[model samples]
Target: MSGYDIVKTRETLIMALKQDDEKAWAVFYELYAPVIINFARKRGCPKELAEDVLQETTMVLMRYLKNFQYDRKKGRFKSLLFKITESKVIDAFRRAGKISRLRNSELFSKATSEDHARIITERENIWDNEWKTMILRESLQEAKKRVNSRVFKCFEEVYLKEKSVEEVAEQLKVSPNLLAQNKFRVMKIIVDTAKKMIHNLEKS
Candidate 1:
């Protein structure tokens, strides 16, 4: 993610958590939950097991966010999420009987020694970040396309304006409750579409 994307996502999450906004939590889930599933699948988990792991991992995330630390200097939200993913992937693989042998349990061992051969970190591509930035940019564009100008503008007022959702609702003459739900709806569509676009871009 670019610096701006990271900052935006982090700010949105923090504000939502502060307000105990269920809609914001749901948006966050839509953006990240698929990543856990994909990571499990890549680590050789079966489809059912992959889904289970994704659920388990998300539950863990929910548990942590009550006390979760958002550290930009340490890395982007992607890194924190990926660290959870890496742990959950290993756990899923273990449960699926892929690594019963003791010596092969280490992350280093898995990357270096597995027959399917995960990419060693030393050789991992930097294009991943570029791809993510493109996807996020496109997803925001797609989200903007689906909503009424007023609804999209309401989202901008609340999220982009740093105004409270309550403030946005009053500005638009809509209910605050409705405004909050709309916030998540638009964000989810944009994020999911962006992920798909990025995946297609990578294939090309």
Candidate 2:
């Protein structure tokens, strides 16, 4: 199978990882390391600190994935990942003597149970947003490979580059109707692909 097919689903990759498949581990790291780094960066970590969190998170996963249980009814793989990355972020902060910064920031108040719950909820929201952004980005790349070059270009100009449909059509010398159709078709492909990607992680 192609690397894309092999790494397409989290469950499949996790199973491969459990068997100590080196390629599967590489694919897993390629897919998730950025997500962890970006999550840490959003939480105000510098690039160096974010890279530290990524390494720490990867080590934790390596130590745990041998027996990791992926029960969807219990929780999502993404959430487990988020929890791990979050723990690493906190640890990195502590090492840098910046835990007080997080506690004193707007996201945290007094460290009470209520505050702790609120912190999790807020941080989860941030994590989810970053995760979705990464998925959309990957989906867009896949969409480009699946669609016509012109169609993908139209979609990029109109949707991603924020160009008007009329302007793109005129520039590309295509009818506005054609541009709209291309936009809709590419959007469907991207959204569908993104949903499937999310399901691969969250559902199974």
Top-scoring candidate (TM-score): 2
Q: Flag regions of model 2 displaced more than 4 Å.
A: 1-4, 7-11, 100-111
lDDT of 1 at 71: 55
Q: In order, what lDDT does every prediction score? A: 0.62, 0.81
Model 1 clash number: 0
- Clash pairs, candidate 2, are none
User: Which candidate has the highest lDDT of all?
Assistant: 2
Question: What digit string (tens of lDDT, one per residue) describes model 1 on residues 1-204?
Answer: 322233245345544644566766565555555556655666567889878877777677667678756554555554555666667767876776765764466753654465444453421222244336446755776678778887788778887788987777888999988898888888888777766554332321
Instruction: Give the per-residue lDDT digits (tens) of candidate 2, residues 1-204.
Output: 323456474547667877788888786666677788888999979999999999998888888877777666877678778999999998988999897876687756646898778878989998888878777777787788889899999999999999988889889999999999999999998888887777676665
Tell me how far the alpha carbon of residue 8 in candidate 1 is from the true structure, in angstroms, after superposition. Answer: 5.6
Worst 10 residues of 1 by lDDT: 122-131
